[model samples]
Target chain A: MTPELPTPRVTVDADVLERNLQAMATRAAARGLALRPHAKTHKCLEIARRQVELGAAGLTVATIGEAEVFAGGGLDDLFLAYPIWPSPQRAARLRALAGRVALRVGVDSVASAEALGRAVPGLEVLVEVDSGHHRSGVQPRSAGEVAVAADRAGLRVRGVFTFPGHAYGPGRQRPAATEEAAALTEAADAVTAAGLDAGVRSGGSTPTATFTGVAAAPGAQGAPTSPGTPTSPGALTEMRPGVYVFGDAQQLELGTCDWTEVALTVASTVVSRSGPKVILDAGSKVLGADHQSWTTGFGRLLDHPDARITALSEHHATVLFPDGAPVPSLGEVLRVVPNHVCATVNLADELLVLSEGTQVDRWPVAARGANT
Target chain B: MTPELPTPRVTVDADVLERNLQAMATRAAARGLALRPHAKTHKCLEIARRQVELGAAGLTVATIGEAEVFAGGGLDDLFLAYPIWPSPQRAARLRALAGRVALRVGVDSVASAEALGRAVPGLEVLVEVDSGHHRSGVQPRSAGEVAVAADRAGLRVRGVFTFPGHAYGPGRQRPAATEEAAALTEAADAVTAAGLDAGVRSGGSTPTATFTGVAAAPGAQGAPTSPGTPTSPGALTEMRPGVYVFGDAQQLELGTCDWTEVALTVASTVVSRSGPKVILDAGSKVLGADHQSWTTGFGRLLDHPDARITALSEHHATVLFPDGAPVPSLGEVLRVVPNHVCATVNLADELLVLSEGTQVDRWPVAARGANT
Candidate 1:
């Protein structure tokens, strides 16, 4: 075979991707929750369209530029789930987005709320609450303050939102999801207490949003799903989980997904091998250098699940095969699942969509480099 | 006054960049070595042109895509410093690149050398030797085997090259450079013994290429330069260092350059703040998610060096300001120096060149996303 595909390129197993999309969509619909999957994960128009076709309410973006890309792709509803500090240029873009689509922005500070209000009057704003991530957002009790400020500045307060990013580590997803629900409930109460309608209470992450009955199982490393511990209905009305469509090593490590559920992988070629140590053409430039503290390695080989990518240079990934495992021959193609799928997807300009081991289409990462 | 320029963009100080270019060129010339700075650091055609103008013999690239882009930009001399396992598609591109420019590819195994030789006849190949980095490259003792194999496969064994990447950690540059020299010497000896002229002995890194006798200074964490430890003449004829033109936090920590010598920074706007914790609009998407063990933080604020970035999200950089230190106000613009400049540059689409606070030009990262 003349090499299945070019190495160091992002590839999505079409069958697995469709299955994941259906699973998440079915779960959300069953829960009676609006599924506005975060588009920052794939940044592809085709994926976003597929998401909407699967009953997604809208899309959540990270930057105004992402909002612009999705809007240009005819995505009319966008929620920038970031406390964006809009410069004059960005403020103009926000204004344009507000005029063109149903835009909702997150606000956690009085200054940001005022600036966003001034940038686009009557813009829908969600008061972000600290649901244990502690990265952004305000205290759940302080959501009212941000809501009042946004209201005073002529902005509309929709409700509250939080990211359970703390749900990422091993044995942490259950409590993190519980905390996410409780924080959203507290923030919703705070919004109502501030004399504002808390209509949209959003809380989720890939780990928390896909809870099944795996958490309480024997020998499980704390699954997202545990019997009778499902997130109480009405705890949050909407969910936003970015990485569910294409799981990663972090998700696998957290028991959020099985090996068969991984949709995205980098098709790489073995260029050189020294005994048991094999090097691939895919490296940090393609796989991205996103190593969480809990990740086993830079990435893992899909074909040989036991092999670990011990290190990465700009254009080379050093993989160490497990004891007695077969070493990949030079010129062999291997599928690699990166540690963080979101960052890995961000590295690619386009994704090669594969169905049954054949490339079907190329989807442009439309929102790539939309940092500003 | 209007904002100087857009926030969350990479900006290069024109003067500092020039100084950096001149400084490296002068050092390489003084040592009678040819400088082929790796273009993967900037991936900018303008910077490559400037390096060529400053007496650089050629540009080194990490990918064939980068080679194609730089070659298209009219830089004819290119060396892809990668052990590429070219698929049929890449082999065609490689043949085209070889026809257009003086091309050299790194090879560390017989299989790759044979494959490359079959793919493109009479291609120039450099046997890559492990100079202590241990990431790629064959052992020094084994380079002759690869060289002889290349010669047997109708490939031209021009010389040997090694990347002194182990020079990256604290108190490691001098020893790493020394090992790099010894490895090159050994590989060159082996090539000569194998009846081939190892005309080019290439070895370098940003930390190893710019030795300035600063490592031994009190409280210094090992610079590239130390007393009486320079490489002997003819040990290495060519040097390839990428990050000297835009020093990063790793360089600062390694004592490669001081703060004034740093050229690139991400201009960001203060979006939200509470007490000592401040958040900037720039985050991992703009600054890149590269964190070295020795790096102080994700990045250091240029205005407030004492303030350290505590955490990074997709679009927000959480900075922790020092006690009694001045905190940036909301909407205030701050320039941040990233930890790894190479990864940071790869995250951007263009670089905003600034001269004395005035925008001069925008250079496209033309060769970006050239992973294949």
Candidate 2:
């Protein structure tokens, strides 16, 4: 359902969002994993508060800037999930944030750990291991080396973590999660061998959240087999799924979520029509230009499933309808599901919180443009 | 040159920006076309003021929200260059804006024209015609029908305009420019045949700005070729070119601009390294994800020419260096040129305006996220 608000508006169905959150929380509880949902997706404090109320152990953030936002909003526990190369100024901010909250940062190398130790000593750090996503993190075999360096530098080496980012591709979630479990096990063992806690083995993307627990259970791996409880000193204890709160086209296409569970969509109006081509005002600037190599189009029409967004400009999305399919008239509103909801939310000023197909509140994306 | 500011910060080289702006103004003036540079590129009030000082005829914006932002910033002339599908609320806003400034809106359909006519009397309208970009606008031959309908609805039919967006691809600039001229001429004739002014035949994109003038001059078509003078009531009188203010990787790869003139770049820090892959803090959230099919990669490193952005996540850009090339060390700052500068600017709250090598000022991207 579309709202009567401005076109290209980012709208969140609170009803659907509630279901999605509850479903994810329930799934994580059943899988014996502590859920620390990523704050980068919604960037709204209202959602973060709801997530906290739903029994989320804490929140996961990507940057010191994001951590500052959440911590300022009274989020007591935060995880900066990145190989954060903090500058002097940022380290000062990190020290300030650590004083206010239960803070933990990701460290992938000895240099990074040493820098953090020098700047923000006594800070807790999770050694990042490369779990098939070569974008960041060190090799699993070198986890202890980094952990020892972190501990020696006066930083508290907590545990090891990995991001199964390769699971984002179609039909790759199973393999990626399997690799994640194996790698996290090896890295955690190395950290334990280094005489550190190695407790918080954090890993999970939206696509691999389900498989993360399934692959890491007692019989599944070294992880425990309990539901609703995670006891870990050397296993995958936490899962961070950002887009699960607002299901997007990527998740829907990847079978990570269903259309009925999608809580977010861009409410756009048809601005131009040329025969079978319907132009929507919601484009890259609003819905985001995130076309994964495997996606059907730039985005998808939530209402008209058969229509494909053939092209996208800064202010226009050219949608094509199948022959004999009804075309949306000019000024007709359409809901567009973004290929990547996180990218879409980052471009918005606020998200219209809707309940029962009516706008009930306006949640400011307070952390928007906090890209320090 | 990079600035010592926050990582993932959008920085504008004032010196390079000045050169680029002056060059485009000179080129437009020499081609005898009114330069109404699209404000969607920079979105900074300071830059819009600079364009006005440089004798820009006016500013072109994509949405009424953007128009309101510029107008509120003391700009009086604005063209909402889209098939504006105004709701009752937006129509009132448009009426208010039309009363305050010299405003013109694009209308490509009879229904939209009638809506505008009913809601905003005497609003000047430009009928949009398709010029090979099948995304929006009507067929050039049917421009008269839309114009006549607009006239019958009591809206002022100003002229016809088209966007040769096909020029964005490689080796298509010439053909796109030629087609733009022919389409504008035919559409202008059709508008004239419908007893309208047909004065503002506006057309131009970053890639086709130069060719637009070259292909439409008197000997080339119906346009006159007097440098720094545009006499128009029937030809391609105005060219609205965005992205010329900030040279991007797309413009660089398309040979539309030289690397030396690139003004805006994201100042990022190398945060993680895995063998040959170095990850930067600036990812799609900072630089924007606008990868044209013909481009080399997501973006380019301004200083390290051999490095390419291999993959982009919300908070990380995986960069790869050529064999034997030095990889950026942890915390080492780098400048990344975005693939689409407009998309990048919209993601930031402010632009670090730099002169020489230091940040002289910070200009707010006032119209950022104004995508309504």
Candidate 3:
């Protein structure tokens, strides 16, 4: 007799994903802004296509590898949304990709702009503005200098973009979004001051998307506006929000989305039961060890929300149930929502897509282990 | 002209790996224990073959996917060290695998033991004992009941095995090893009491391998015993230590190995730089976000040991260096040792083998993303 495959593999809720896409689309439409969500979160062509079909004008990617995966899969409009210093090898890939799609690469330094312009000949570039995430991008005031360098190198200057990543901590979303809008507006103005069109003034994280100006005023006369509200309608023309497609623990903590919107989960089986603890087959390798200090545990148990996965090894996740909840028995299956869905998806080859608890399709996480 | 593929994707220092392997082999040999090091850490057939040539009697695997890869590579003696509850699909695979090699499977419950016996007739089974890791494994006292079930179901009973996983964290190596011995001894006694010859009493983690009975007291003596000492002589017939083959950040933190012994490092390029911060191309996706609260950062930078990687996203690791350190320029490559090597390796498809700073071969991490 043969044994069945062990459970607790990565799964995507198609219905939930559709709902997230529709919600983002509705929000973008109300603001009269173009939605070009970042694909770095899902890295799946299918999801990218879904976003596009649901009113996303294009897709934002973080690497050439990701751009290639999406481009090969028929995504024609893409933005490599990082201030990437393209070496010759990467530049050539970028050049080829530019010819095949409406590719917009990011630049933060004069040398990078010049190098990309020389390598690609007719590449479109975006000046990356630092919207307080402080990881990358130039200061909002420096956007003009970078844009002028791109213009001198004969590259097409599009607009400016910033990631309000600082908005993702425990209770920093609201203020971070406001800061993000101000920074993006200043950066866009800098681009225009440099005699550039600044066609796309884009900036928004999942945590800040709701605050992107459109959500500032409710439809009814006395109704309260949603939390994140961008200052003005024309402040930014585009929004790039990833992670909304596959909500995880971080989104839950940041209040970016509610539990009903979380589309991705790891289906694991209870394999061992010790005193006050039940171990699942899904461990750090499967669920990923991305516990933020404030996160309740390694991950949250979907079947029993009160249970906390206290420990994780290579192939085992030990869940500790609260006093009142019943412990899961051996062979019982449970879904685990990871602290970070992006990292978890990167750790698997494929995901089982489910709709209404039935297996729908198996979509390959195209760029699953493409670390380099 | 076609550009060359990127160099230094994953650099493995052969000298360091060999040194670590030799040290563990020497320590295990002086104690009279057979080294059957776990291959789940590296998942490379080259490393597995090297361990066998270095006197490793057999190999330990965590999943059937891993076992299949090694078995296909001609590794004849193998042990699926995980307490897998044999489902029909797995049982068939196990039975087919057993026909090709000396296969031993692990079980922690009478139901699973009986299932394994019925599914794969004539298979050898080891009762898994919980040795304080509290993740998986049955109680040491329950070994007899499980063994009896295996016997009644016509399966051959091997001794017992336990993983002192608690030894992985900081400052717990020694105590965890002691508990491992105690648990294994108790399980072994239970097996004998159940009318089974518990032939192999295995225990030892990479961190606690030195503290096992075999390597314990004899080190202080000037005259070393010929092969095995009276107190430590094959106290446990076999030893299974995985990460010893590729020392990582966890090894350094646990004091099981030194930084100089770290063989594996993710080589990434600097992609973004800001005031007092630099972002590497590899982030949690490549280096893994497996840092415990005690861990300093997402990973440690090899070039600048004092630099701390303060934050990480999917594709970017933000490192902060003190005022006086030499800052890396954009496109300059750097090596990072992940806090948890196992999770990092599982995120890549292949390992770029390097010897003396020169590229040698690229070996596939065959079971790289085999989360299920």
Q: Which has the greatest TM-score?
A: 2
lDDT of 3 by residue, A59-108 (tens): 99888888888999999999988877777788878888988999998888
TM-score of chain B of 3: 0.92
Greater-lDDT candidate between 2 and 3: 2
RMSD of each: 4.4, 3.8, 3.8
lDDT of 1 by residue, B141-163 (tens): 78888999999998999999999
Ranked by TM-score, top first: 2, 1, 3
- Among all windows of 10 consecutive residues in model 2 chain B, the one with the lowest summed lDDT is B226-235
- DockQ of all predictions against the true structure, Cα-based: 0.60, 0.72, 0.56
Chain A vs. true chain A, TM-score per model, equals: 0.93, 0.95, 0.93
Candidate 3's displacement at residue A218, Å, is 12
Clashing pairs in 2: B29-B228
TM-score of every model versus the real structure: 0.94, 0.95, 0.92
Winner of 2 and 3 under DockQ: 2
lDDT of 3 at B242: 86
- The residue-by-residue lDDT of candidate 1 on A235-327, one tens digit each, is 778999999899988888889988999999998888889889998999888887877778888988877889999988778899999889889
| Worst-scoring 10-residue span by lDDT in model 1 chain B | B212-221
